[model samples]
Target: MTGQPLDAGTIAELPKVLLHDHLDGGVRPSTLLELSDAQGLVLPADDAEGLASWFVTSAAAGSLEAYLATFDRTLAVMQSADALRRIAREAVEDLAADGVVYAEQRYAPELHVSGGLEPQQVVDAVTEGVEEGVAAAAGAGRRIRVAQVLTAMRTGGNAADVARLALENRLRGVLGFDLAGAEAGHPPSRHAAAFRTLRYASFPVTVHAGEAAGAGSVAEALHIAGAIRIGHGVHVIDDVVLGEPTEDDPWGVEKARFGDIAHWVRDQQVPLEVCPTSNVHTGATPSIAQHPVTPLLRLGFAVTVNTDNRLMSGTSLTQELAALVEHAGWTRDDLRDVTLTAAWNGFIHHDERAELVEDVIIPGFTERSNGRHRA
Candidate 1:
């Protein structure tokens, strides 16, 4: 599940699903260059490759705080409704081209208000963008569907407002609510009211925990915040028991009889959005070879791989899969399995999602694995 250089044609034709990518974090570097230029905002870099490297260096190779700071630049130019809509549309278009059949893109709307666009306008722009992008994809025979996950920055004081915005758009393309930001100081408990409000509305929710923080933060996300999905739950390994290697089981260890909060998450089938490259860049894990995702996958956890920030991480879902396959020793079957699991576990309608699994995602991958989908 770590590093694979799969055939480019295979990757392009294979159906994929993404659940944890950030709307602001996945912007096209060229789009960033053009938008920032019009806004008279000088970037840390000028060209696409430089801008792309700048994002990865800032996000993957930087500290958690520094990784987050990269968003400020993207959000700064996305204040206007037009800008937000354009970026969202293009985000979907780009994902579709990468062979993504479904993606649930999340963003903290609190950061995009310099132009005084109302919170509703932010949701509207994103939903409109999805519609347009889906149409464009259909025209190209890619066929992609997207849902927006509205995130409230736990460090920001607008959790309640963001929660409201997510609720308002639930009837539209908004599928869930989430709290994202610095996981250390800003725990999910800090936004108890926002979680409570969302709960009252009977809305589904996911939380970005266990990345910057460990077991304690994950506990609060599930127990207090009702997070059905975990964003970057790589730190779940912290609670696991790993003993010395032995003969019978080369990896001699026990699933701690005393299950930690993270174990409960896996045992209970809560999906972890495992972004391998982003995890490495942020020092969430020491190396892709040692990523907790491989172990988690073996343990039968609902582990779904993703590119948490394509632009910032300098990766695509295909690259993420390739990395996992080549480095992590994942086979073609393993790739299809993860894609299917992600398709099932993503925040979409049960009926629509069922169709996605049986029709688009499963069929495409299944046919490919069997050589039937190959052209």
Candidate 2:
């Protein structure tokens, strides 16, 4: 294959890694509609397309504030244990069909107890759903492994409660911890005690910073919370500056200056979970074409592409990667590099992560681009 943008079909068939998907946010339109109706929940739109369009428009209101409000509908329906189970199982099925070989999906359990369930109940339901989903994928001739990342709403209370819940279930498919929800006023340092607890437990953490706020939030997430990865570290690009160059360096390749926080993220190879469509919806970036995915990749940053919310942003990992190739001018080999980076940064056992990078990921990309070869 030449160094051109791959079509949607080709992108859909390649093995993919997704690190930032939200479990409740990725529900299918039809499923959401049906679930709402079953629970006697009224919606603004009657048909599935109309409801989906409503969500996309609402989430695209040019501010992270409005974008996050779109979750109110989805979260309301996830109150019951059964509802959580069904959505999670279906999410994994959808991921497998979309060529997601491995995924780390996150959701806040605190959002699910309004219907009279305990915190641990929500975790168990989600864990069971993940197991069923993996089995469903295998029965369909695809093997997919999924890990749950429990999210603690920054605007809500008692993050240490959520952190303890995630640690309790870590032996049961719960892999990591996150601080999601509104990022404006709720700095990660607000939950310093929870981070300290998780750190003592040696659990991997990914904080949602630098998307709604600036580099300061990212710094707190790293230093205070001990974040191994970031959810949408887009604003770190603000610290970068490189005016045009002259002479033999006509490529405009001056040093891309970074702040102390940015320097640590880059030098430590802390992965950034970038969602192109979601970023555009929240006005985090201008256009999908202008997303920093490829620039960070070429600059030696461990950048991995993701779909923050398939329902809200209306995208998959394959679609995100395809957009990068089409609009960002990335090559097929570049896609492979990003996939490997995601697998490495994934919150999983070291042996399992290594197996994915060595066995499944590299071989699938090799087969897709160059076809079968001699031994």
The number of the candidate with the highest lDDT is 2
The superposed Cα distance between candidate 1 and the true structure at residue 148, in angstroms, equals 0.5
Candidate 1 Cα deviation (angstroms), residue 214: 1.1
Candidate 2 has what TM-score? Answer: 0.95
Instruction: Please write out the lDDT profile of model 1 over residues 25-113, one tens digit for every residue.
Output: 88899989999999899999999999898888778654677788788888888898888889999999999999899999898777777
- The collision pairs in model 2 are none
Model-by-model lDDT, in order? Answer: 0.83, 0.86
Each candidate structure's TM-score, on Cα atoms with residue i matched to residue i, is 0.94, 0.95
lDDT tens digits, residue span 26-75, model 2: 98888889999998989889898999999999999999989989888998
With candidate 1 superimposed using the best TM-score fit, by how many Å does residue 249's alpha carbon deviate from the native? 5.5
User: lDDT of model 1 at residue 27?
Assistant: 89
* Number of the predicted model whose TM-score against the real structure is largest: 2
